[model samples]
Target: MSNKFFSVSVTNISVAILTTILISACAGNRIVNNDAPVEQLQDLNDYDSDGVIKAREKCDNTVLGASIDNYGCGNQITKMEPFKIKINFANDSFAIPDNAYDKIRVLADFLKENQEIKVVIEGHTSKVGKVNHNQTLSEQRAKAVVLVLIHDFKIPAERLDYIGYGFQRLEDERQTEEAHAANRRIMAELTHTEHLDEMEWTIYSVDQEL
Candidate 1:
């Protein structure tokens, strides 16, 4: 074998041409449209820009910046509110008073909006009266309020129930006018489930790399 030495000098322009050739060779099947290589790394199938790809995404059109799950659904949330309404009645009356109409209407509106809610209208009386008489009066008071809800506000019959607790669950045990007045009242306990989409917490942004 003969010893042969070859001297090769490459210019900057020649080196650049060789580099472009190597890059083109590396991208054998991939289309090169003068775009950056980073585009190839991004998930182009994700149309909504959510992390989940189109084939796997269960939810579509997910809001941008919403903290989405693996299924790509976001903005679905649940909420609960502690609601109570109190309306005091006269010494020996079960009438829905003029002044108490606004609060009752508000309660009705709440019920109208929240279809899943059920309301319990409770009635109580002072200890000065006989237990049996007070119980009957309490029953009347609660029933009166419930009727107003059903008739006036168009509240559904199935969503309402009345209960009497005459002198049993007194707000104050003292034998004073204020205590008696406070004890003689109608109360509504509200229960429901609330869900909101627009008012949800999030931890995502467009600034982040997809």
Candidate 2:
């Protein structure tokens, strides 16, 4: 074979091997994005001279693909403010149901795209159990969601925090399961007060070097 053909074959083999490794490493935590490539996510910053998707724009999600000016953040996009998305759990369990996946996916994607946002996922529980037990469960549920975000969604760990509010933050004291269920949820807080790019962390120098 010619050197060019031989080199192409070797390159293809190497790419395949590397892809396989990546897939295996992330298999257990991968989320299914029907539109995303099967192997990995395309960088959200793809753009053209005119700032359009290479082809006609089919999305309103981000601007990068088409006529987007700010990494697909739409014109109406606001900084990640203190927003709460509730994830309900079955009685006495912290297992996230299959139905809850999409919400988590959107959250993970949002956090990934906006680095200035730090989140505190507070888990809450109804008053059915002892206060301590409820607190522990609530914290565990929040951590569980964090783990899923890290392992499956590839969200960085440093950007997340988990806390159990127990029944302390309950919405109401009604005795019905429906009311209790309402109390069992995860609420997110945006810790940074400024826009991501404008937020700064400063380090002060001591008078003497340690």
Query: Best TM-score goes to which candidate?
Result: 1
Worst 10 residues of 1 by lDDT: 1-10
> Evaluated with lDDT, which candidate comes out highest?
1
Could you give me the TM-score of model 2 versus the true structure?
0.54
Pairs with steric clashes in candidate 1: none
Q: Which stretches of model 2 miss by more than 4 angstroms?
A: 1-80, 195-210
**Ten contiguous residues with the weakest lDDT in model 2:** 195-204
lDDT of 2 by residue, 1-210 (tens): 899999999999999999999988898686867895566444444343334443444333342222334432233334446567677898889999888888898888888887877888889899997989999999988998999889999888999998998999888789898899898888777666442222122342243234
What tens digits encode model 1's per-residue C-alpha lDDT throughout 61-165?
877655667778754444444355667788889987798989899889989888988988888899887899999999999999999999999999999999999
lDDT of 2 at 93: 93
Q: How many backbone clashes does every candidate have?
A: 0, 7
lDDT by candidate, in order shown = 0.80, 0.75
lDDT comparing candidate 2 with the true structure: 0.75
